[model samples]
Target: MIQSFRNEKYDHKVEILTPISGQDHTYALLATYEGLAEMELQNKKMFEDEEYKELITEFFLQNIVQGSMTTQLFRTMTGLKKETNSQK
Candidate 1:
């Protein structure tokens, strides 16, 4: 599925989300690539981190939990406290 949202503040900018698909979920290759691109933009550092990449790969191999993946990526990138667990 393609998820898109608009922000009035960004005016011309539109946010499109394409999360990865798990074994149970069927997703288009283009959509998954788009999601990866979005994640890269959101968290460049996390993508660059080898350890983080491995963890993410493992998580995806197990299941593509879009919400969890996105949330973790965002939190890791923003250095914000996680919803369930706080990180220093």
Candidate 2:
């Protein structure tokens, strides 16, 4: 799923990956700014709380397929394309 939101005068895109095997959910948000870069550089955080997972799940559902081609391009560049393909 993809979601777009404006931050710091630049539009940011979020891509959420929900695994079919019940693994921890992962997401990547991309934007043309240092803050986004910093977020990407940070260590991955996994959510064990049901409420947190539900919140994130709802967010992803609302934002699904709402992003532009550029977001998809970034997802590809970030290696999610390959990961998606392999998962299928």
Candidate 3:
């Protein structure tokens, strides 16, 4: 984990997060990747292609729990904490 501070109304300093320290993250990645693969293979032109699905999986695997509202969909999936003003 890493701790950093932001110049908020107060010192927003804290231990940020402890990453997945074992194979669970890997399994979760594989599971989600497979789901994307299934969608790409079966679903039509409304969405994903092989390359696009690969890109999505890559992003998901790289940051399962990012601290940003723009990544809302991912936060919901990974159960990431709610974003605060300081986090933004």
Looking at model 1, the pairs that clash are: none
Best TM-score goes to which candidate?
Answer: 1
Candidates sorted on TM-score, descending:
1, 2, 3
What would the per-residue lDDT of candidate 1 be over residues 18-55, giving only the tens digit for each residue? 55655544342211223556645645654666765776
Regarding TM-score, does 2 or 3 come out ahead?
2
Model 3 clash number: 0
Clashing pairs in 3: none
Top candidate (lDDT) = 1
lDDT for each candidate structure = 0.43, 0.42, 0.38
lDDT of 1: 0.43
lDDT digits (tens) for residues 1-88 of candidate 2: 2133223212333444565665344344543423545444421221444544666579767765545324432222443444466687
lDDT of 3 by residue, 14-63 (tens): 22333477644332211121344543444353133565456556766777
| Model 2: CA > 4 A from native | 1-45, 66-88
lDDT of 3 at 4: 18
Q: Which stretches in model 1 have alpha-carbon errors above 4 Å?
A: 1-42, 65-88
